[model samples]
Target: MGLRAKKFTPEVLLSAPRRSEGIPNSDASKVLYSVSTYSFDDHAKASEIRLLDSKSQESSLVTDKNGSSEPQWLDDDTVLLLHGDEGGVTHIKVGPVQHFGDGSYIAGTIDGPVGNVKLVRIGNGTYGVALTGKVKPCGDLYNPEKAEKPVTTGREFDSLFVRHWDHYTTENRNAIFLATLYKEADKYKLSELKNALKGSKLESPIDPFGGTDNFDISTHGLVFTAKDPDLNPATHTKTNIYLSASKNFWLDIAKGLPEFFEVPISNFEGASTSPVWDKTGTSIAFLSMKTDGYESDKNQLFVIPDYVTPGWVIHHFPGGSSGQGTWDRSPQSIAWGGNDTLYLTAEAKGRMNLFTAAARPTGLNPVPSQLVKGGYITSVKVLNSGDIFLTSTSLIESSLYSTVPADHAKRTLSGQSYYTLPVDESPYDPKSSQLITKYVSSSTHCGGMFGIYGHQVSEISWPGAADDTDIHAFVIKPSNFKEGKTYPLAYLIHGGPQGAWGDSWSTRWNPVLFAEQGYVVITPNPTGSTGYGQKFVDAIQNQWGGLPYEDLVLGFDYIQKNLPYVDTDHAVALGASYGGYMMNWIQGHDLGRKFKALVTHDGVFSMTSQLASEELYFPFHDLGGTLWNNSESWSKWDPSRFAGNWATPHLIVHSELDYRLTMNEGLSAFNVLQTKGVHSKLLYFPDENHWVLKPENSLKWHEVVFDWINEHAGLEKYTVWRAGNVKKQPEDS
Candidate 1:
């Protein structure tokens, strides 16, 4: 008989506070980060900014304002904050105060047309990137729905990607504009902004993945930008380098004359992105991929000290690997260190580890020196004295960490203020040693999700494939879990097959929500996962399904055998993209019988269709070659081939505008289930893209998913109902 609705609900669980992101000050003296607060029920929630004072290790709220993001520190005294102000509009604000007292002051009110803003010191004057929207005006920065837009065609779409991811494309061009910053008696104001990229068709700073690294400023205040090579707005995404010597350099161009002072850099054989000037500003360092049309190509770190010459005097760092010995599936962000060295974080062994290399060419191969070997580190900075400040995250906790060259001990200056990093507490008496007495307490953001605590997070490792290589997985248990209590399994497989379920908390697929429903969640990073080493990541190619599937199966078996609390009979498998493909594959594998149900979100159901995807390189590289030459490899792993035998009830979610996988994949999978007459449901989001992002939609998604799992896989109470029947779950022998 069908059971009544239970006490568990998505209301409280979805409200769980999660860490939004972390940003470090230029001086490494303070850290600014945003965390989710559930004090309000709005799914379109904004994060509160909190500052961590490194010296005092004291944490204080900067902006209690509901959803701030992109926290950037201009200096020890100034910080730049961009966040949703009113009606889901992004507002940029920079202030003289270090800590948010009266709260965050919006800087764009006088700066310029608010767009994507970044602040860089240009000589004695301050400069920023914003949209003036004068030529093509950005009429609003607060509410897109009510945005007083300029009347043109008013036609929403003159093209593709009019609706990107979750929201419709705004008229804003995200151009780089100059904010006239001046000081009046100890007081300052940023106003009189104008478009700087005059006579340019390129988007300012380049997007959709561009960060602050997308553009850089020289000591002389000149700006260097890597713009996507597309001039006519093509589907293919690749970037090219451009530079402006000074503000007046573009004055002639802005007047519609080709007399612009700026010029395009050397056109390379491939895409060049993330340009940064050296300390001396003599040369620049950027990551270049030799092959065009492919985003996954291994990067070659190139230094162009002679940018003014006819072509870049390209110098390749011979020793280190692409992405600077790190696997950057996207454009790699690199930082400059003392002695002209570059420090980067690479995906290695399921961790985002730190590595460093010099800018100048070395005679031998550049094998980067691995520094911070554990946890996930991003936004690395090097001091003149060789000190490093970065943000690190693990399965359970995340915070800003500092390392001095002397001892290299990670001083947890933020989050958990552990002067003594985990597992390395000193033996000396706490009273005798200069020890920090208190830890950064979990924020109000933590202990959220209807005030229900998250699972006890930990890690596990298992062997894989023919080599029996070690694979890592982040495992979670229901809050206040007891060893004797068996719980349903929520096997959450991550995408990127290149990405790992690392120590840091995730907002999208948080294990805490599953734990709140009394389910044990296991996020596995199989053969293709990053931070494992280049060889491991490279192994996923050609053998996509062959090896990674073996790793997943064996890892699941290991977890089931080891963790008796997992009710395997009532388990449900869920994944997105690559993980989704794995879930589809699982439908045909013997593992299909182990799970009560499955969920594939925007998964790759057919390689044939994916080859024609908006992105061409990922499929071209991962499948070894083009489909014509490697038909066998493509067919061997295509999840669609196994759909004929699918028996388990499944939920297929595909966004209509998911150009990456396209909507056909999910539709095809759902069609097969319908044809086979198996129990299934299909969720189509016409507004969303590859991921569900709209707050209300995301909330509904969580509710529906949990309700489905409740009926199909026994979320909390082990009431498994499969294939339209309440399957008798096998009890402990």
Candidate 2:
């Protein structure tokens, strides 16, 4: 008897009735954070901690709050947790694991001074800390007695025009204070808490999104923070690493007591942060950039040597291909397990994988292996045994897993031997793991299903680059697809031009959603995508609209011609960021009538305005200059220059707080559509940043986008006309 294939419906895929989230944090810990949800709309917004017993091989769930920031083990019994509030205090809780129902463990917050912790580091029973204080600038160190009290108009007020992500203001400026950990019989508490840095206006963890992870303290009581300078936050933010002994320091502008001393020199010309202390102390390893003013430049791994003068010793690792030890892939965070073992979460192809290498500069091209890939590895923790516990999420899975090298101490030192994952070379699967349960829902009234449930999701490749480079693309077939039936295509262009539409699951631009809407979805990760190799990625650098665009065209042509069922005539081009720029390019350039409609979200309209986006370094490094210096270089790629030919109906989406693209970008495109009198609609999210994160907003965004695409391209062409938009013959594709 032949085996029957599993058939799923859109309702089953979109509904996603029930699923348990694995640990979302990449930070290493004995307990993992897991959150379960009934549906997208039915989630309680709280997280659960999954504690595994090494001795018993048993796992239990602990109820936790969504406010929990970074969770780290305090000791054998206690765990330190950081919680942040937008309008309230930063809660720092440290206590022994609390057992709740049955075998579940819930960490209870310590009800003490630790409640206002902005950043913390725990060692045995001793905790080094930084607390937040709201202080209005007064000439310079007005009165220590009046530091806590709000100042009326008795003294001059210092002003800073700070703007970030979504909002701006001076009221939330925080002053960093230092403290010591004191425990009262198992109850964690804070003692000797004083203004470690006074009379200075500096937010250690920055604000909004940054927290404990941005700052690190050395074993010798030296605090290193990559922080926002006390000045007007502008389109360009230059964050220099400040190293100061863990003592009371002050920055009085009037008296000139610079709060923190900056690093004098570095291998890279740009900003630096994420300092990881070597286990033996005396040195620091951090992520660095080569171009000043550009935050998105090639991220290189650098180490700070124990020298008499303050400077960084750049290490030439695998990614650091430049003679000076610079790598292209961006390093998110760094952690040291041993003196020579440095583990990094870096981006390549499309996945953020864990890599291991020597901790210091060897002037050697330290080959870093993708210990764990096929997903987004957010953070890592180093245990005494050298085993790594990490949180990884994919296009279809979520959670944490543990991986141990055969002999990491030796492998990392050699920087040549490869590390391995518990699972073999396959997509990260959550269903096979015993820790998480398969989502089962008895309720039939939830919502709809999606692409992954009803169709096959696979990655395909075709020749694209001039050197016959094979460009990778992700394709999702429609649900219950039949032979000889043509389906409309949702050709999605990924942003980043430097980024890729990875193999992982996503809440935004979900191809499965389009597949559920009765369209064959194809997402091409042409040149500039990571994972492929440095050459393929570097090809898209100065040639953003060049090689990457050509590769997309070739990939699209191949997909339509080869798939047979992909209805190219009735298709649409959709993208965000750099992809959006290509959508505009399509309206002016190639594929005359390939896409019936277009959807662009948070995409660039003009390189001129996009140059100084958020940080000046990105434009400076990528384009090689600003709008003034290299007007001719960026001019050719400007979408508005060729807007006269934009006849296709378009849906423009942008956010007010997306400093990267800025609100004017969408407005400019919308204005051009109005001037051209083209069929267009502008969807604006005032509260959202670059991505639509809010639940309701996201739902609305999906509904609007889903409905728009269906109405324009995904809708079924019921009537069988002699010659419809669909291909008359497979060969015509």
Q: Pick the candidate with the highest TM-score.
A: 2
lDDT of 2 by residue, 1-733 (tens): 1111132222223333223322222232345443434254464344555555533434565435556544455555555566644434345665455553333232232222222343234455555655444444541212233336656744443643334556554454544555556566656665544544555545555655555455665444344554445434443445666666322222121133334666654445565667666665466777666555554555567676652234545554533345324454567788887776677887765667777766654665555554555456655766566656554555444333544433643554554433333222233244443212112111111111121331256678889866968888878876667889988889899887667786555656666656756788888888777666656666665676778778878887887779888898888889998888888777777663577888889988888897446555566556757678887778866777888888888889999889878889899998998788988889999999989876567766776676677677748432222135224422110
Highest-lDDT candidate: 1
Score residue 232 of candidate 1 by CA lDDT.
26
Least well predicted 10-residue stretch by lDDT in candidate 2: 437-446
Model 1: per-residue lDDT, tens digit, 160-248? 44444334465465555555444455434656555556456656555455555666655333344544535323334456666554334
lDDT of 2 at 493: 91
